[model samples]
Target: MTGLAKPQGVKRMQVVIHAGAAFTDDGRLLGSLLANKAALAQSRSLPLGPRHSRQFVKVMSDSVIKDVPVDDAQEDLREIFPEDLNAERLIISSDKFFGPRRTALQHGQIYPFAAKRTAYSEKLLEGAQLELFVGLVNPGSFIPKILMSLHEDQRESILGSTDLSCLSWLNMIDDLGDLAPGVKLTLWENEDTPLIWGDIVRAMAGLADDVALKDEYALLLSLLTGTGKTQLLELIQQGTAKDRQSLRDSLAGIFEDHAQPEQIEEELDLPGWNSDIVSAFSELYEQDLAKIHTMPNVRVLHP
Candidate 1:
């Protein structure tokens, strides 16, 4: 791997870290940001691909966990981000940044170490401005999926004595606020991603409102039928959806009629779970979102 050089006498480094709540995104967010690399570069923003992200995680682990010197850690960063790149802002993303799936429900709750992790990363970045973006999934769907990702023997151990009803994404956000209070935090619901996909990408890239992007509809397109895709392209080509809001409104209308059933539907087959439990979880998630909106220093993107 190439070494990163410490940036000097350039723009103050701004680091955007996309910490995924597991099952929310599998690099699709990063992929979307990457699709507009040329556009991002025009604004002096660099989005690190998976290789750089992994290198970053390794450096952070070595520095914080293995007691490597801060200087050494900064040197390792030089490999991931060359000094000559001179980018003003850097974007790094990984779902595992929040911790592996097995560790997600630690301490009888979700991501209890999240705040400390964020703080450690900030410190290791040599005081770069920190921004965190995360997408939250309703536990009704999130829990079962995460549980399924784990080994059978490991599942019960991680979830010991925790009440499913008590799991709250807001609690995790609150911890971030209290511990890494200086970090800018951005959040959105996974379900709302398709609708707010453009906004999410623009926010992460710090792109101007008037700036345009390619593949903005990639995620939304993946979930649509051929007919839906054709209709959407026509809508855009004809300039029917003049603004962001109007485009989103048009997509909503199209999705209602043409979204693929299997792609949009989340299957739940966990033991002792039913429609009622899922509905209750969805209700709690909505309530948590309301409280999240009121949080200071946090930006919640909506459709």
Candidate 2:
């Protein structure tokens, strides 16, 4: 008996196990089971039997266990376990590994949805913060609500209605609307943009007196254009005699510089010249004098 063929003396061991997380598909669950079995076999020093050997019986059961539908795993595992015996392990470790892994998978799958909810919450918080800041700054006023109610384009329109210099004061209101708590120091400091309309008015008044009328006129024209100058002149033309006299004095230098010298000589000699020359000169003088008188404030030059 030449040892009844040495292979016949080798005892084949077999075990079966089932384990998985709730959402494990068949292939993944099978892979997990094989991995667990390999780990157990490596630890226990067992020669694993073939996965489909009829000599093996199901030794473990779980919700995750199901018959293999196709031959992919069989082909892959053929070389590793050639003996006709199926081996498996208890699914306890498999269940433990997959439980949390399954939960993590589920969480990752729905992560986008959770992120959207977080973003919406952040926007709501931002709105609440903005509202609270506005309330604190305005105290008794409802300007913040009014600003919020307006469309973006309308906000600029409303701002335009107020003076440009007042923008920094308005920004104080805006800062209060959106600023953090420690930013109070910004309010205590003076801004380059002025806050008071009265200051602008006083400056304009000073310019009105200290600057020459032409300079004032040019300044006004530069700021407001030719139509504004025409309107201002029309208004002055409608004023009382005293007001007109003052305007005339302010404007007299302009008119005198533009008057004709021939007209001046003719007007001075008006009552006693040769008739022909006198008539011709008289007509010319009359026309020129009329032109000068129509100006703001030219005086006749005497000879």
Candidate 3:
């Protein structure tokens, strides 16, 4: 694709779409990034582009806020992005792209998300420079969350029929390809939030490799209380990289020691799911994560 046209002689704009694999981000990525844009730019945490917040908002809104008529999208883009603004990239972050997160029945069937099969069919960023970034969670946790969102009516028809054992998050992600053909897709497991949080921010910004970043630890600060990250940092600081098992062990210990007791606990009020079922589901979740790590063209961001 030639990319979204800019002014007569301006540079092409890079667009990043953070299509949510729900129950993942919880708004921290966009919230913290936008809040610190000014300071971040000063420190060169992200690639510098349109420096003004107003200009930045325009770029994001036009791409994600509402429908930009298929016929006039190019014209609309030119208006939203003035060449003089020198916008380096546009980012549209949304969980709504695929529709509400829900499943009427269990047994591994995810509902309505199929509509997302064509969600990007409009080619919202058709001619523009575009990149798609998605976060995924194992069906173990994801399936339950979708059930929680169900209304009274939906609960019976949908939640009543779910069998958590048969869920597959990989299938959902793989489906995106057929819907939005030929798009460059990047996949990262949300379960690794703490370790790869910085990478996520950097990747989204389309920043350079050498740009020294400040506040890299800011994302974890909230989740990891005092002394919570010490051991993990020490392990990472060691000359040799640790194995997956060791890393997981260190992180689990640190988080257990530092995480707020209440925060770590979950209350899944769904029927047919007691602590045992949940634990089994969680075990399966870990297995799914392992499988995801091996997929081709899908980048798994780890420490």
Model 2 ranges off by over 4 Å: 1-14, 18-69, 84-303
Ranking by TM-score: 1, 3, 2
lDDT per residue for candidate 3 within 34-84, as digits (tens), equals 755764454333332333323333443454436655555445455444555
lDDT tens string, model 2, 243-273? 5346544333333443334422222221222
My TM-score estimates for the predictions, one after another, are: 0.92, 0.14, 0.71
Instruction: Please tell me which predicted candidate would have the highest lDDT against the true structure.
Output: 1
* Model 2 error, position 93 (Å): 5.6
Better model by lDDT: candidate 1 vs candidate 3: 1
User: After superposition, which runs of candidate 3 have C-alpha atoms over 4 Å from their true positions?
Assistant: 1-3, 6-12, 38-69, 72-85, 102-122, 160-164, 209-214, 229-253
Clashes of each: 5, 2, 5
**Best by the TM-score measure:** 1
Residue-level lDDT of model 1, residues 75-140, one tens digit each, is: 778778774765878999988776767778766567877887888887777647889999988888
